[model samples]
Target chain A: MKIRKINPAGQREPPAERPIKRRATKIHYGMSEIVITIVLVILALVIIIPLVVPLLFSFKTQLEFAYHPWALPKAIRWTNFIEAWKAVRIDQGLLNTLVVCFGSIICTIPPAILAGYVFARYKSRVTEILFYAILIGYFVPVQMVLVPLYRMEVSLKMNDTLYGLFLPMAAFGIPFWTLIFRSFFKSIPREMAESASIDGAGHWRTFFSIMLPLARPATVLAIIQVFMGAWNDYLLSLILLSDQNKFTMQLRVASFLNSYGTDRMPRYAAAVIISALPTLILYLIGHRWIIKGMLSGAIKE
Target chain B: MNVFKRKAVLRTEPAKRKKKDPGRKVFVFLCVLPAILFLAVFLYYPIEETFRLSTMKTTGLSNEVFVGTDNYEKLFRDEEFLAGLRHVFSWAFWSIIIQLPLSFFIAFSLTYYSNKLTKPLQAIFYLPNVLPSAITAMLGKFVFAPNYGLIVSLGKALGWKWLASIDFLGNPDLAFWSVFAVATWAYSGFYVIYLMSRIEQIPKDLREAAELDGASMWCYARKIVLPELNYPLRILAILCTVGSLKLFDLPNMMTMGGPGNATVTLGITLYRHGFINWNYGKAAAIGVVIFVLSLVFTILQFSLGRKEDETI
Candidate 1:
């Protein structure tokens, strides 16, 4: 039995509460530090300007935008945002994207979690092959399946519907989450299930009451990752869903901007902003969870 | 011989089944059923269909005419597809060299520099990745747009008339690199956070312990941090390569694989063939090649990752 190192809040225990380690603290108010800070600040400003440039242009008039390299807008153009919102039909797109996110999570998460538990606990030749077989799906590029999926969806009369888009999105999500959850379930001690069984709890009873609750963090991580995947997806939604009314934020925004005939610069900027702002705000509020979920699943358990 | 083999399997299976509950098979079946349904119906079936499509002349207006391996022959002879493949390798190469090291350097600086600035600076750098790539590409376009763009306007202000006159995205070769530079800028922040967090995961006391042992900061980093980071760096490198292989949205939205196919990735090639040209057979052939290449990468990733696990 592997002992679980239950480290709470990621804090390591102090090394005998040591003293006289000024050298280890490593530099205070030095020239190198100042140089590093100046260099990094400049680098940060330059790198951040891509996202910031759109926001700046979204405010500027066409004439003003053409002339200014870097300037505060002479007058803020809320009209630009307004026009972008109408042009992209972002309100509808937002509604559809939320449906995709939740719809995908619902379609995939429960089944993946159940499948993950069995794969983690059971040992057999058949299960091992099944596990790797399902994992192979995760490796396929969406491009590989595009033509056939289109044909399949149309034949089933599932094309141009919200469920049609989300179902396939969930199909891809299931393999990935199954991998994450299996790793998580493996970290759990088998003794919990064994004891429950000893106390006459059936497999279903032990799983539902005990194992499921224990996997709350992993489940939330899977939810956030799946939600983000569905949120940021452009290709699948672009191809599979044709109705303008049902377009996801990415599809609508990309189609609006990528119209080859004209460059609607200010509106393009605004539409891009409208498309991205909510998620950036959400990311700000939830960075800890997002980072933890993203890295912790694939890299570490 | 088959009956004897069955008898051997049955004899071993019964011994292994002695402690198994009657409900075990049912429970396992319930757990596995949904995944099997999805993997089979959606993913695996579609893959097979892609292979089947590759052997035909599919237009959907007419019946798919079986062309055997002729489509594959045409694709191999196609210069555009080969160029796209070269572009993918180049993109992956640049990402691993330029982007990975940039992430590593900044992460090193941030961790060693000061305590107060790390959080805010990290947040600002990480802001790029939060938005969609469609937005990232569009934003990148305005910055590099000719005549009245960011680079040119700044150049004109600085009295560099040649820089202002240059059209970064209009030229074929330049367009590819400009998009590459933009991607590296947008994505480096993500890996910076990855590296920094990995650095942060090393216990505080361990650093102090190294210091107590008379090791300098550089010595500690080289000895402790670098070795610890080796595997994760390898994994991130593979991910970057895989991501480059799937390069679609950024190049697609930014350049539209334009100025005569300068920035066309395998993905863009596939998309154009299927949707734009209305030729699904050639597209599916490209898809099979991509699928094979990525499977190679995935298997490499798994084997490398598993090798580390064995050591642990």
Candidate 2:
């Protein structure tokens, strides 16, 4: 049976005694918080300025932005929305992005959970060797795999297909996601599994009926992380599928920039705002959860 | 009554004596089979292929020749490749020089002085981290739009012709820094969020204690907070290092490594030689080098992570 380490705050064997010399060092932390805060605010402005500037400009006319680049728009260029939409065909790109995201989520998450559970519970030399081998997969840069993968897809006649992109993306996301899931699963109390076993549940029954339900938080996190990754991806889509019709939103949006015309800037403006919307919405809903997950992982380590 | 107890005890013996089930073991293996198989095919196979192709030559006409070590030799001597290496280091230098400690400062500000006003301010700062890189790149393009661009308008009016006279994207000397600035703009928020998350993990007692002791803010930060954040700071450094080396998209979009390859990174080089130039052999060599570089750095990162884990 695995033993759980008592957390630092929970250790109560002895009264917390302070060393005299260390007390002086403790005095420095509060003043530091102020300094840290000031530094953070200034840095935030530096980052925010560039991001906010273009967004502010998106609402202005070309003439307005050129002449008063830093000023607020005279009035919102509401027309730019429809114009960017038509110019970039953002609706179609969003549709494609959605399809790719859901498709890969379906492909990626369940297997990761099942695999993570077994690795965490089964505990054997073979499993240990296999888990390390899976990690080696993350070492190969995405760029190196592009050509051979493209060749492999073409030969298999899966080129220019959504399935083509979906499978590879799912495959690539597995290694890192699996690592996260495995570590998380390992942290769950085995007593929970023991109780399920005592109830006469078999491995499969315990996994599907009890363990999967309990692992929902991590699973949701995995889904969102993979969704974000698949959404932002440009290189894989650019290389794998040649047909413009098959383009993911990222590729489509980027291509809009190169579209030859005097109206390119407005189109560019629309494409960027449109492409960022789903992510923004996702962030609004899932922001707190994602941040919580990251902090728990980072700090606990 | 004695016979009944004996019969019960006898029945329990068989249940206890039942052999370990090979069937159950196989079932467990099957459960993990899909993940293992996928990694082998998608990941393990391609890595092997890169190493294999590095030794072979692919002519445009479809001939493959075995030319061992010649590719690596050629790379060392290739002026263009050397220039690309220089660009990557310089890119990394400028980015880390500005962005790393800058993130620490932002994180400190957002956490320390954060009120209703600054809380929203922090969120606004992190907005870029959520947006897709493609959008960030496009936004950068909007701001850098030559004569009518934001920087240009501000510059010429202020009599800063050097900024106006030099084409930001077209000039070799300025191209790299311009790209660096935009990349910094896009990513500094991400690092801030990362580091800030770590800083928040620190306990509240330490903060209260420091405040009561009349410790100046700078001393508290330098002594207490920065030490605790040291691990994240290290990880961020390694991530930025690898990122700068393999930087593909920003330079591609902004300069196309233009003004004659002044801004080309190893990633750009591999893409150009392999995809655009169709010199598959040379591209494979570049890929191999990149693969090795990525592997080495990843190992370094994990080792550092492991060391921190041990200390804690």
Candidate 3:
């Protein structure tokens, strides 16, 4: 990779320029900058309000909710969280959700990394076709396979099982993540693997020892992303896992809210918060990684 | 891409390694085989099955008779499905025009201007994208609760008397747009996160140099950053288009495609035919069409985007 020097005009290419150069570090704050800052604040509020409103409402009593959703709760209530847990059987839902999230991650990541390495390193005609064959799956909408997926699940007697829920999700994810890992692997120089081979390391040794450790960033990005995705899944869970015991966090929360609208407004809000908690905490912790990963699959290496 | 390098490597390889080549090929096959097998069974075969099943009238995934293209023929004339297509286009229209630019601005605001609040602001904006669409849809119900939503309650509280409870989901006229608003809130942050991250990867020195050279933020964003973000933007557009076509969780869970099928999308329509009515043939037909539409649309967007890049 060659680094292109920024020409005198501050563009990547060497080009004719017109701007007058001034010293760096003294940023002039103008009216538009202030306006954009306000706009940014407003936009942040637009997002924060909806998310935070539920957190506030989760503590509001019925009368308070009816009277003033805008005002603060007089007292913080842990009972609302407990009630939300019971309303949705959120404990079970959480367990099921975690199982699906991690189970799918378990089922998906190892294969993606392995295949991605092979696809990137060992180029051949068959693998080339195989690579594109899997890549094609990325574009096929899930709805296209819905009817058959259900039929297949039923025939396999995997319906109403957690495995049924996550396995297909895993299968669907394999192609996209494989594509991501493939690109990530491609970016690493072949010389590393070649040198390792020349030192009498087998292909597996080179992959596991050298290449795999080097791919930690992509791996973390994929795990967090795939975890979030599995966490948010509803359409598949709704179709396959019909039993209440088998319900995912999404299904439970949605059903709870539907069953008892805002009648128990606080409880409903509590349920919303509880369901949103994991991803929120995850985002707050690993947002930098999440954002990078979100773009990882989209950007060309 | 490197013609001489590839030839040189090939020429330098020893014949003695041929003994190990067969084993290495086998190792490579073993590595990639899982992904190939999974996609074949789960995606490609199901796609082929969908096409086959679409041409057959079936009940309960069994007891079927061949009915060549009848399902598709009926789909073309089916009023509700056509309405669903119209709804999809409208959804795509709003998503591309409104959601795309709003995300761009949010990303632009976060990236172009350096501030202490940038990370936290970006984090908050990105939260909606991480939340399940189901949860967001439920929130939409709460937001437009008519009887209890702030719009009505606050109207009552302040004694301003005329904020008539707008039936956002109940009214046939407003269901689509109401859902669109929810979709915007839920999905706009998604693109912004990607755009912001992608934009941040733009060399900071280039930006600093431009700024010091008296190039305003707007001019830098327009002339330099936009071109750099060309690939991601193109992807976001395709995603928005395909996403609109396959939309399910929010509208379906919230409205059940009602206000009398007024907000029905292709996805909801497929769900209705397959799961609700057990009209597998028709459902599969819808599926086939949806798949083809996404494929065609994706290819079209990719080509158009490539053309734009060439011009750039």
Native contacts matched by each model: 0.62, 0.47, 0.72
i-RMS for every candidate (Å) is: 2.0, 2.9, 2.2
Which candidate has the top score in DockQ? 3
**lDDT by residue for model 3 (B1-312), tens:** 599999877876765367468778888889988877777777777788899899999974569999998999999899889989999998998898999889998898787776898878887887788777777887777677667764566676677666646677888998898899989988888788778777877898888677656687788889889988877787788888888888999988788899898999999999999999999999999999999999998787657656655321
lDDT of 2 by residue, B49-84 (tens): 677777878785347799998888898998778878
Candidate 1 residues lying further than 4 Å off, grouped into runs, are A1-29, A260-264, B1-20, B203-206, B209-219, B310-312
Clashing residue pairs in all predictions, respectively, total 0, 13, 0
Q: Cα lDDT of model 2 overall?
A: 0.73
When 2 and 3 are scored with TM-score, the better candidate is: 3
**Model 3 residue A178 lDDT?**
85
Judging by DockQ, tell me the better candidate of 1 and 2. Answer: 1
Query: What DockQ do the predictions score, one after another?
Result: 0.49, 0.36, 0.53
Q: Docking category for candidate 1?
A: acceptable
List candidate 3 segments past 4 Å from native.
Answer: A1-28, A68-82, B1-14, B203-215, B301-312
